[model samples]
Each structure stands twice: as C-alpha cells, then as structure tokens.
Target: MKRKDYALEAKRFVDAAGGKENIESYLHCVTRLRLNVIDKTKVNEAEIKDSPLAKGINWTQNQLQIILGTGVVEAVYAEVQKIMEVSNASMDEKLDNSKLEDFKLQVKANKETLRNKSWFFGEIQKGMRVLGDIFVPIIPAIVAAGLAMGVSALLKQILNPSGEQLNSLLWIIVDIVTKTAFDSLAVLVCWSTVKRFGGNPVLGIIIGLMLVNPLLPNKGSIAAYNAQLDFYNNQLIEGLSKNEIYKAWVEAGLKWIGQAPTFDANGNVITNAVMGDPITAIKVWIIPITGYQGSVLPALIIGVAVAYLEKWIKIWMPKAVNIIFTPFLTITIAFLVALFIFGPILLMVEQGILIATKAILGIKYGFGTAIIAGVLQGIVITGCHQVLQGLEMQLVIDGSLPGANGAAATGSIFNAIWTASIISQGGAAMAIAVKAKDKSDKELGFSAAISTLFGITEPAIFGTNLPKIKPFIYASIGGFFGGLFAGILNVTCPGMGVTVIPGLLLYTGNWTKLLGIIGVNIISFGVAFLLTLFLFKDGIQSKKTKLGLKFEQLKNKIKLDKFKIKRKSAE
Candidate 1:
C-alpha cells in the first residue's frame, strides 16, 4: 500500500549488484538500465530480479540489462549515477596507489569491447550493441522526418484537389525541413559512428559530406529514371523501343542532356537508358560514383574506416601537425579507401540486405511476414531490433514501387507489420488490467497499455505482460495473425516509427490500404485480448488472485473494496 520510490529501488539495484565499487559504468536506454560491471561474479541476479520495479532482466555482452519499463528506468538511472559517484569517491580514498592503476585498467577494459569470447556469442552481441549505439540516438530524426512527410502528403491531397503540385515558399520550407533529414542522414550516421569509435566527429562529418557531394548525381534521380524507363518499356507503342522513347523525349526537351543509367543492386551501371548511346564510363560511371545521399551502410563503413584511420594516424603524427596535417592525411587516405574499397563492397552488402528483406516479405502466402512479426518483439527483448531501422527508412523513402497487375508495392510493409506486432502488446496489457483487483495494479496496467497506442511498448511488455508469460504469448499470437493479414492485404503506411492511433494520421489518401491496416491492427489487438481473458487456462483462479472488476461489473467491486479496507485497518 506504500507509494513506490524509484530512487529507493535504484539503491536496492546497486546494492544487489555488489555496490558501486563493482560497477564500471552505467547508462539507460528507453526501457532498460545497462550496467557494465567489472566482475560479473559480484552481481546478484536473483536479488535484482526479485525487485518489484524490475520487469525483466538479462545479461549480454558482459553488460547487465535490467528492464524497468520506461519512465522508471530514467529516474532509477539518475539515482544509480549519483550513488556511483558518491561511492566512487570514498572507495578511491580507501584504495592504495598500487591497486588504483589496476582498478582504472579494469574500468577502461569494461568501456571497450567486453564480449565473453572471440568465437562465442559475445562477438555477435558486441556487433549488435554497436549497431544499436549507432542507430538508437538518431531514431527521433527518422520519426520526425516521417511525420513531416506524412503531414505534407495529407495536406497536399486536401489543398490540391486538382492534383497539381504546389511550390509555394511555405511548401518549400516544409520540404526543406523534411528532406534535410533524409538527404543529409549520411552525415548524422557518420558523425555518430565516429564518436562511438573515438574519432573526431568533425572529420567524420567531412567524409560524410563528401559521399553526398553535388558532383555525383542524386540517387533519387536515378530511381525516377529507372521507374520512367520501366513505364515506357511496358507502354511500348508505334514500334518505339524503351530507349527510343526516352531519347525522343530528351531531344524534345534540350533543357536536360545527361546520362541515363540504371544501377544494379550493387551500385553498378548495368543498363544504358538513352537510345544509341554507348555505355561509356564517362556517361554511366558518374552516376554510380556520385553522392550516396540517404544511404546508411556506405556512410557507416566509411565512418568507421576514417575513425580507425584517424586514431592510427595520431599515434605518430607529431603534435605540431595535429591540427592541420593529421586531419588532411586522415581524410585523404580514408576518402580514397572508401571510394575505391569500402564503397563498392559496402554498397553490395547494403543492397543485398534491402533486397533480401524485401524478398522475404515478398514471399508467397505471407509466411515470411508472419514469421518476422512473430519474432520481432522477442528480438526487442534483446534490444537488437534497432538494426531494422535502416531497412524501414529506405523502404518508406522509396515510396510505392511498380508491382504486378497495375498495383504498386507498398513502401512501408515492414513498418506496417512492426506496428501490428507492437500494438498486440497493448491488447495483452489491457487484458491484464481487466483482470487486476488492486487499484494501483489496474492503473499501472491500463497506463502501460495506453502508452503503446503511441508506439511505446516496453512498459506494456515488461510491466504487464512478461510477469505472467501467457499474456506475452497471447500478444505474439495476435501479432502473427495481424502480420499474416497485413501481408495478404498489402497493408502499409506512409512512414515508420509512429504506430497505432497516431499512426492513422499516416494512412491518409488511401482508404483501402488504411482500412486494411486498421483491420489487421484490430484483429491483432482483439485476438490477444480475447485469448488472454477467456482461455488463460486458470483464468478464473487467476481472477481470484487480485485483479479489479470490469466496468460493467463494478457494483461487486465497490463492496469488495470497502470490505478489504475495513479488514486492513483491523489487521
């Protein structure tokens, strides 16, 4: 009956983890507090998991991740930091000089790679966490950009009934705000990667900027050209070939005279677009070699290369030239290597991932999508789901691609499944709320469930569903059905990140797809809710455990509350 105190909970977590002396460093993410401890033996796993505040807990990559939902994690993290600092000062005073350096060494060791072994699961975990470190911070930018694009798209449909494009200053400003994030996203990725790898961010950004330089043709232009070619090729008439049609149009409009090339998945110029034009390096090479704009992997590899290269250069590059020569040498060597080496290799890897993921979604009968959605949340349990952000962003950015039977493929299919998988958590949590007898527990369940309607699910998953296990299974089942329907119906969104109710704002201008997505979401939620309520196996027995009454059943609840209050006072 006492109010919960996060600070007190934080102190307990630290004490259970062998105090501040054992912890090397600590930080918090959206749903968990990650502690990098010096000695894993010192951590008390059983005691930590026993705390009421902890929703779930796991150890990976030599770091202890305590899932404490969302808001509580932040508060607890602050308390943990304060406790560590205070304890650290006293511990330093007590330690002798001989042991100090060794302690510092251990701390430093924890800060670097702390994976268990080279060939063990630790390396994969380390890579996944590094990926998380790179992409997690930039999620806001992706979401904001997606929302702006959605809003702009909705306004365009309403304000321009004739379907004429708008180019007013205000619209241009909106374009700038939204486009900058995608267009310049490479810089953000490079900057983040460099910082994570202990290199100068300014230099990282310079290398990033070089990738999207104006000298190269824009990637968007190439896509448009490919789409146009596809269109003309299909509409062949008057004995004109695809190249002939494109050339005629070019000649008609002298305003444009440039190479038209179709790039393969690996960024190679595989097709010549214009008629009678030789596939010369001067013509198709520039496009492949041009700016990466909106790319992820290329910039990422280049960023890491530059970071390590810069760090390596600093080892012998004398202090006098630290300012000028170090940057120049690092940039020069890294740029050449990226352009000549990592650029081609990484492009293939990036394209392969995109194509492979889409290929899975493109599987017959929606089995691939169903499997992905079923396992997505389980992946979130390990915090490695951040790796999917890039694929989702690129899919959304690609808009609708040409598909069979005059129906275009949806741009955000992955996002649609993601939303469905996540929304099911809300349903499961609400099911628990419907079963809770204690007012506080009921409130916590309801609040956590509601939070998921806006795209946050950790609270619902950790706080309400994970405790019983059945609710989690029910929610995932809901997601599986939702995903199967989503893929079959070709349900999709205009963006990524946002989901559920607010996600509706993105479904504008397409009633069929919108309705389809809404239906799947409902199916996902309803199935989970109904399953958790009716077929919980021991549903009746569990209800007697302490859940509150349903709204329609509140009369009995009132009498029950009064009787419990009286009994508590007497005790």
Candidate 2:
C-alpha cells in the first residue's frame, strides 16, 4: 500500500465539508468520522468520494459519515480536530470586528435547534441520539472488558476442565482485567453521560464512586451471608440484607435530622408513614441507590438532571461565590434527587427489563428467542443494543444463564444471539465478493467479509451489503434462521465479547454449546451465500437487463415509424 499524507487528507475533508463553520459537531466510531453539519448542501460529496483518504461516504441520522478504515481513523480525526481548532482561532481573530448582534443571533438559532421539541416521539428520537452519542464512545471499553471476560473463562476451562480451583497467578491477573472493567461499568457510564449532558464529569465520577462504595453491602454476597446470620427473639436481627442494612445505616447517620422507621403490630415496620413525612421514605429508600453495579440508566437520568441544575446554578450565583457554592450545591442536590426519586424508579425499570428479557428467553419451544434473535441486528443498527451490555454483565456476575455453572463461567442469551446475527453479515459479504463484477468491489467485498468474521461488521454492512439492497435482505434472512437455530439449541457461551472467530474461547469447556455455535455460523453463512448467489444478481446484470429492454423497445418504435412512412408514400 502506498503511504498517504493524513494531514492533507484531513485538510481536504475539512474543506470539502464547508470548513469549521459548517460543522456542528464531530465524532468517530471504529471506522467512520461522523459529522453533524449545519448545511448538507455545503458538503462536496463528489470531492470527498474522489479523495484517496476516504473509503466511502454515508449521510444518515442527520450526519455525514466519512468512512476511514480502522487504526487510521484516529490519526485522521486528530488531524481534523487540529485543523478545525486552528480555523476557529483564526475566525475568532477576524470576528473581533464583526457585529455582536449577528453572533448573538447565530447563538440563538443554534440553541433553538438544540432544544428538545414538545412532541413526545420527537423527544424520544432526541433521547436516542443522546444515548448514541454517550454510549458510542464507551463501546470500545465494554468490548475490551467482554473480551477479557471471555479470555478469563477460556483460561479457567483449559487449566481446570473438571471445574477445580486454580491457584495460578496468571488466573488472578486475567480475573482482575475482567472484574475491573465490568464491575466498575457504572463509573464509565456516569463519566460518559455527564460529558454528553454538559455537566462536569468529575462530579459524575464522584457520584458513581458513591454508588459503588466498598462500604455498602454487596448485593451478591448479602444473600448468602443473610442465611448465615442468627435470628433473635424469633425475628431476623443482626443480619445485613442489602437494602435493610444500607437504609438502617443511613438513618443512624442522620438521626439528628430525621426519624427512623417505626414498628407496627406483629412487629412489621410501617414504611410509608415513617417519621410522618417523605424524608423518612427518602432515607429508607437509600439502599437501592447503592451499587449501581451493572446499571447505566440511573447514571443517565442523574446526569440529565444534573446538567440542567449545574447550568441553573451558574446563572443564579454571583461570580465571586460561584466557585465556592456551585460544586457543593450541584453535588448535594443531584445526589439527593438520584437517591430519593430517580434511583428507585430507574432501578425498578431496570429490574422490569431484566424480568421481561428472562421471561421472553424462558418461553418454551424457543418462540420468543427466535423473535429476539431475528431482530437482534436491527436493534444493533439503531444502537439500542448497547444497553443490553449491562444486562449481559449482570448475567455474567449472577451466573444465571444456562451453561454458566462454573465459578469462572459467565454468559448471556444476548451474547449467543448477537454472535448468530453477526456471522450472516460475513456470509453475505462473501457472496458479494464471489458475485461482484468490478474488481475493486470484489476486493472490498472480500476484505469486509474477512473483517466481519472477526466480529466487526460495520465495514461489511456499510461497504457492501447496505449499498446493495438485495444482499442486505438476503443476509438478514440468513441471520434470522441462524438465530432461530441458536434459540432452539439453547446455545450459551461462558462470556460476552469477541463473537465468531474470537468467540470460540468463550465456549472452551462446553462441547455441546461450542458445537451449537459452530452450527449457527455454518448455517448462517451457507444460507446467506446460497441466497445471494442464486436469488440475487450483481448490479451490472440488472443494468444490462434494463438496457436490453430499452434497446428492444427503441428498435420496435423505429420499425413502426418506418412502416407508417412507407404506407404514406404508397398512398
């Protein structure tokens, strides 16, 4: 491959996209530079596609995405950011002489565009966009953690096939990587959410740390330990349930400020009317606020409110006292709101989703599983699939999913479905490679197919399948059937992350599950390949058919005109 100048490419991209002023915001995923532009007309699409640096361009979700291959995107993005910063600085210097009213008007217009519409569905769209912005940046971390979990499971399986304990230092190291990444996920979510919502991320980190504080009772350990505690006076006493313990501790600490729960007839505690006010209710409800261990929803809710509150405080407080009061008030108010209101509500919502998912997967005959598996990729495309990671992590910790019996074992039904759904993408890409008429298209198809096998499908989806509608449809069909089979087999891996080729490690000790996964991949690939090859044809073939029909029609029309002229001459 010839070496290309990334700086020049970055400059070309900026220039073609109508310079810094036209850009609203920009971010990058694994393989694309996604930019939200103020004016689509200002973008020079032809120039961007013709540029050697860009692999492709897509305009969707109100953003212009320039496809730059992985590993190079980071460098290109850095260069682009640098160019934009320089351009902004120069603009600022020039704007010193510009009218202030124009700047104010521009700001006002931008704010209006940013404001959420009153329509409920429109607000939902905005919420989804916010989630995508916040979560996309954190996906790499989650993926890394999931891979680590898989690796740890694989190592344990290899060293201890009988599920015996391993005292190896290497196991400890592997375990650390898995635990630290998945266990502290709430912190990452909080940090990302705060930044996305325009609040100080440091405050978010503090809140997250408070939620997962080591002093709080661990939900997993409390259940087992509660059984070991002694009963007093025929009543459970001296036992630390996760909720009861935290609530009692908080009441004890705030004894001077609020009243504790009062006992009623039959020694049952009256929770609702405790202390004759909502303060007692808030204090007693503190337990659910602790250990946001596998949760992102709570962080998101808290961040959204906190961002507004922070802004409000800045507006009201005097500049001299703002430094002293802003952080104090922001933290105090946000934490209270999170603990008293949003925490319980969001936790219930989270629990509801978990129960709903479990119920769906628990259905006999695999009907529900098949439905979920079929649409898993569609969910992924909309970016809602990232939310499932929290559920998967919870499953890993609980060891609830089937085939996840061993101490080191961890898995989720979501992981199995995702794996099944992804392989079909590769299969479709392979078929395209074989059927493509253009050499460049064929090469891209081959590359995308290989990339998808390793669990990266953006290249395949964007580069090949999406551009050709029929191929994508064929691939989706393949995914559906493959997912259905996975559901029927009740296939489960020991961990999340790194599907397809790298996912083999997650099923190391479970032969049946491993075979099931292999079957799913084979079926998906074979079905997609056959469907694309036999049922779908290359774009060139379709074009040729259209051209042939047009030629025939033109020929017949000329013959008819000639006959008319002959008749006239004869007369």
At residue 364, give the lDDT of candidate 1.
73
Evaluated with lDDT, which candidate comes out highest? 1
| Per-residue lDDT of candidate 2, residues 1-571 (tens digit) | 2224888888888889876777777777667787777645457889999877788876543367788877878888888878776655676675544443444444444334334322343354344455556666666665455545655655554555444345589877777776775567667777777777667888878877776667654433332222112111112253434335324323211111124445678977665222212211123734554345555556667667777788899998999999889988988998878666765675465455545766777777756666666566655543234435545544433343123253543345556677767778878889988987556557767877776666666546555675455677788888878877887887776455557776765676689888988988888888888999888766545633543354346446444223221123544
Clashing pairs in 2: 410-494
Q: Give all candidates' CA lDDT scores.
A: 0.65, 0.62
Model 1, TM vs. native:
0.51
Candidate 1 lDDT over residue span 30-123, tens digit each? 6678776665545788898888888867655456778887677878888787777685577778778646666555444433422322334345
C-alpha TM-scores of all predictions = 0.51, 0.53
